[model samples]
Target: MPRVIVVEDSPTQAQHLGFILEEAGFEVVLAPDAETGFRRLNEEHFDVILSDLHLPGDSGFDLCRRLKADPVHRNIPIVVCTSEVDPVNVLRGLQAGADGFVTKQRPPAEILGCVRRVLQRGCAPEPSPSARTRVTFLDQDFELTAGREQLLDILVSAFEDVVHINAQYRQSAVALREANRKLEQRNLELQRSVESERRAHEERKRAESHLIQNEKMTSLGQLAAGVAHEINNPLAFVINNITLLRRDLGYLEAMLSLYREAIAPLAVGRPELVEPIEEYAEKVDLPYTLENLGRLLERTAEGAKRIRHIVASLRDFARLDEQELKEADLNTGIASTLDLARGRASELQVALETVLGPLPMVTCYPARINQVVLSLVTNALDACKPGGRVIIGTCVKEDGVEIAVTDTGTGIPPDVLGKIFDPFFTTKSQGKGTGLGLSISYGIVRSHGGTIAVESTSPGGTRIVVDLPIRPSPTAAP
Candidate 1:
């Protein structure tokens, strides 16, 4: 194997050259500068020296001149493997006595071929004095003292490489322009497709949103009416009981006034005066009045308490004062929802059953969860006909709590089941539903990082399960 020394200022380039030469069965020594290259040459006889034009201490051009000046090393071949491909650098390398000049851009095979050719010529005798020529290039004067044939060979080979590289660059430019045109055309088509789809999606969202708002208004009206009914019954009985108590008090007050006037004037004969008071008390039916008054007061108090309970349930369901997330009991929300829904359940003749199990406190928007419970239970009740049953239950789960609403009524059809959660989709008759209930509930659950799903068999019944994390995700919005 022929020994070659690679001198390159860049460590990476030196390694690359050394690897190529060694892979081709040459003994390669790497040098990071011209000084190192000379040091390596002194230690061992090298057949070829591959060097870059730029170096930290001494350049490749300087190395070429010094080597050619030395009598013993002058015969060694030097190849200037540089990235500088200009005519100026080529002339300078040749004038400095480089045996052959090759650009770093040349393929490995071409570089290897150049090196082999230079090695063969290094055995030839030095060029005669008459063979040297004085030449002027790029406005600089230079004498080419290297072998005439060898100089011409290196120059011609470099020129051919430059011409080949230019042709390749021209072809690459044309191909790149064509690729760019196709990419631009494809981008325009994709932009148009995306815009059209965007408009359609926005239109659908707007329509669904309008329907959802209308449904919300309808639900609000129904809730108001139901709450009013729940309040009015207790209020009416309370007023009636107060009226009866007032009339009995009036009779007793008149009898007491008559006894005071008659007994004060005749103290010794007050027994006869007491007879008139007794007769007046009998006319008023005082004993019956007293007995009924106590009952009326008790009934009035009970009615007042019922009214207060209805109001409290309404407050819980609305959660008007609470907006943000808080540690709340899901069971409490469920109970409140049931309290508000009991009236509707009674009217529908649907038996409302509960199977409440132990549940953990969940961090959530209490009002929204209450709304979810109400929506689910109301749907369950609506699904059932007379004598049907709706069961609402809650239990603890691994990471959270689950609420399940099961109803014994007509279940969803298989074809429509998948679309149930889709906005504005419903099985109810026209004007009966806006169909955003379950969709809204789904959104609420998703916002809480929870899941809600339904299980149903046609004509058998439907069970909707809602799983809520004990602690909602931080990103959850009220």
Candidate 2:
């Protein structure tokens, strides 16, 4: 609570001000003159002082000057209240350093308001606006009673400025909140867009890799077809000529037999013809040659037939002109693939063995199945060391046929075995492998309505099994 001193000569007026100050939670002290007021001030501290212009001794103006001049009392605010509204009296209050001048006729609320402002402003110097107006425009006529309104005006203006600043702050707060909300929304949207793009990028890359794999397979099919045709043409003529040579040799041998029988009788009389013929027969080993000539021709004919069979398998496996599914023997396809991979097996010194079980013809894409077998067999050969063995076997299944390629070599490591079918993952060094063989083979088998699996352990060798449906599903067939 603030403390105030009342230096009024009239008890009624002084008591009225004291009632208002006391009601407003201030400690009130009363003195009738400057002398008594100064004594009370000397006894204890007071926050504000109220005094009357006319007093018994040393009036309010003189008290104001004296108190303001004192180093100890100068900080306390002094307010002058009197019926004297004359300009000279107001000017005298101003010169004496009075903090404020309020007429005794003013309302209690306005008086209390002035004291509140004075307390809030504290010990700062507040020059009287009315004093400045009087000094600057002395020639202008103005009523002294109206000067108090100027002080209220200054207080009202300060309150209005505070209200305006609060309103502006509220508006800025609302704008900042809206901006933060929008920024959070944009950040979420950006995150979603980034995730979507990442998935799309991955899908595009996979599609690209699949397309390249398909294109290579198609080109390879074409090459195989052309090679088969070139080999078949020459093979036909070679077989036909071998057949003719075998027949002519049979006729010549029969005639030679007849001549030797006739020469047996002529040898007693005319030995000249017999001697030359016998010498030629001895030099040529005629007995052994005649015995083996028929068997040699048969072997040559068998070799020709084998060559013809291999060529036919190559043609069926290529299937360059055939796009639709057809009846195919898995055993035959495996044999064809084995034939194709034989060169690689030979180079790696891996023996190729086949155990083809009796299997019914299944409707399938023969060329694609052959490709899968070839890839599997080639991989097995690659895994083998010198003198290693690769076995390709086909067996009958309840709903499909199984082709398995087993190799006797170092097995696939457990850690890498899982990723063997993943695109671009490989254990083979550098350019030795593209890492797409098993991945493409997996896709091919799936497209054919089949499943392919591998089994291997460290140093135990590896076995790959392909289980293909006897006939592709109606929806799966192309």
Candidate 3:
């Protein structure tokens, strides 16, 4: 029978939920608060947990969060039973990692339905072909098939051997059996342990990477600002020179035209004056010099424009602001990030393509979100070779917005896929990456009630997707 744990502070409420589950043919375990509920979970297996929003010590949301953080318990679907059904409360419950939420005022039938659905979905599946087969000496090598009595008799007889040998063998058998049994318990616990360790390691690495990247970016930003200032000075002079040169050319052209007109009349009236004017024109090389000067001014103007654009891009990239959540256009952020990545793209000779769809305005920190988009785009550019393409697209989903950045480059290895988002995890050469970009981005997206994931092919490239929830205003209905 499926086991269910009902955690509520009120004895009557707990009993009511337990009774409902018991009547539904479930084995029910009751706890008055989060502490006992969690203790029971660690001691035994339960298919699902029905938790009240308010407990004595820790709230239901906290319990759900703790459980989700533990891999071993994370998968046991938690249906939050709460009186608070406000949008903010529901959002908080989801963010805290509850699998489902049902109001405490809900009918018993509704509660039962919720419990049944959670249990059916949360139950662990049978071992498959690829599943690891645990081996234990007691179950694998020994034959205890006769009966429990026969097995006990065999054990007693076996113990009559050399004392040291019998003790060693029995100890080994017991240890192996215990290990196997522990391994066979609810997978959520094991998952929780592994995930917790992995996240801890990742967090440490991310902190280090963030420190390093910030240092590098700070230095680079200063250098860029200085260089831009220096270039602006020279460009100012160059542009001025072009303007002066253009004026000089215009004056020379006007003088030459006047000379041509004067010569046309002088040929008949003052032939001698025409010769002197022709001589003057030959000495100045007026035609060729004017043409060359015009071209020079044109090229100089183009160069100055290019420098101005680069300087503007650098200024925008270096300007950091405090984080604030507000309404933002995803397309506008992408555009800014693309401009900031121009230098990187130039170095890689990669092409960028964007196909943006209508997206609902999402509340977020613009600068931080821009940083994430830039990091992702820069990573994509670095991963690809010349002639490769990076495609960024955005669209609105039913629940929120989705942004995807895809690159046609050397794809990630399957073995390393899971670790890509881990901090300090990089496939790049030393000095090329700090590796905190994606990890930090992952955290940022999660903080906004969103998720970030990646997909990649063996020989193709990688695509990173980000999803953000649409937060409605308080006055809005459910």
Candidate 4:
């Protein structure tokens, strides 16, 4: 078997090189440094010397120069093994009488191939140069005494290695670009898929939210209807009894007046009987009581009517009777919303005002319109302080009617204003908001071919305006 010595300062590199050469059917001798390698080389006859450039004591360059100068070891071929790829270092290694050069970064097979090629070349004839050549390279000066053929061989070999490395780099570069292109394509596909899934999820969530709000409105309508029914029956009898009592009180007053006329003549002779009747009348204050009784009944009836009006407003707000598309007065819807939100306004001490202008009836989903109005008004009230005011107004537009809810509250922050209609977005404290009010309202308005927008008002306030078409296209129908 061909014998080779590997001089490497690193134990791992020495073992690795040893393994590769031994597996290639070569006898391997491992040396930790140049001193040990030099001793080994002098003691034994080796076919090849694979020495690393970096050593503990003398470097591989120094060892090569010393061996080439010695008569006994001058014929042995030396290959410098290193990780350094600097052209200056390569030239220096070749100038040191190294027959071949291989970098550690090269594949193991390439390193082994380099050694085999040198072995095949055997030994070169010694040349005596006329004079040493002094050259300046990369701002450093070096004096070399190698023959022209040796120098030519070194340059050609280095140039060949450069050409081979360049070809490999080009192929690697092409492969890498193709890989990156495919990776980019894959990433784009993944992004598109994720975006599509996100849109689907949002659509599903929107549908579910609409359904839940509809069910809530339906349930509210049923409850309101039940409450109205329960209250109306008793209210009817109370109203009837009040009417009857007022009529009977009028008859009794006339009869008492006639009795007073009849009793006046008896006052002189039947003084005791007239005196008892007059004293009882004076004690009871019958004259004042008879005068105020009519007014009292009228006020009581007015209060009962107010109660009835409120119940009607609740039913109107829920609008169970009008579920489909129909002509609805926007002003009336605003009124119903105001009525429903009145208690909350009162509790919050927020003033509620209406600037209702003449408006043409808009064909829309009445319940949905009412819901939009209620949502806007409720949000307005919530944004306000105790002394703040909310104004709900309706006006006629050229193509439709506009409902505006303006509040004297802190205006929405610039950053938060844009995302107000985004689903599940809210500024309210957790548990206090579901964050779907404006989103649902926006959907509702759009379904009716309407547009809802908001703007900041003067002196820290907000105004939400909803514009609804009088008669929407068929596509807008829910």
* Best-performing candidate as measured by lDDT: 4
lDDT of 1 by residue, 172-261 (tens): 999999999999999999999999998888568656764664466447645755776677787777667677766776687677667566
lDDT by residue (tens digit), candidate 2, 379-399: 888888999999989899989
| 44-163: candidate 3 lDDT, tens digit per residue | 998889999988899998998799778788778787887644545554665565666666655677667656655555533322434423323433322111223322332332232234
Task: Assess candidate 1 and give its TM-score to the true structure.
Answer: 0.47
TM-score of each: 0.47, 0.55, 0.51, 0.85
In model 3, the runs with Cα more than 4 Å from the true position are 1-200, 213-248, 263-289, 321-323, 358-361, 457-459, 469-478
Where does model 4 exceed 4 Å of error? 1-4, 8-32, 55-58, 104-130, 255-291, 429-432
lDDT of 4 by residue, 196-231 (tens): 999998898788878877787879889989989999
Q: What is the lDDT of residue 71 in candidate 4?
A: 92
Q: Which ten residues in a row have the lowest lDDT in candidate 4?
A: 122-131
Error of 4 at 10 (Å): 6.4
Lowest lDDT block of 10, candidate 3: 142-151
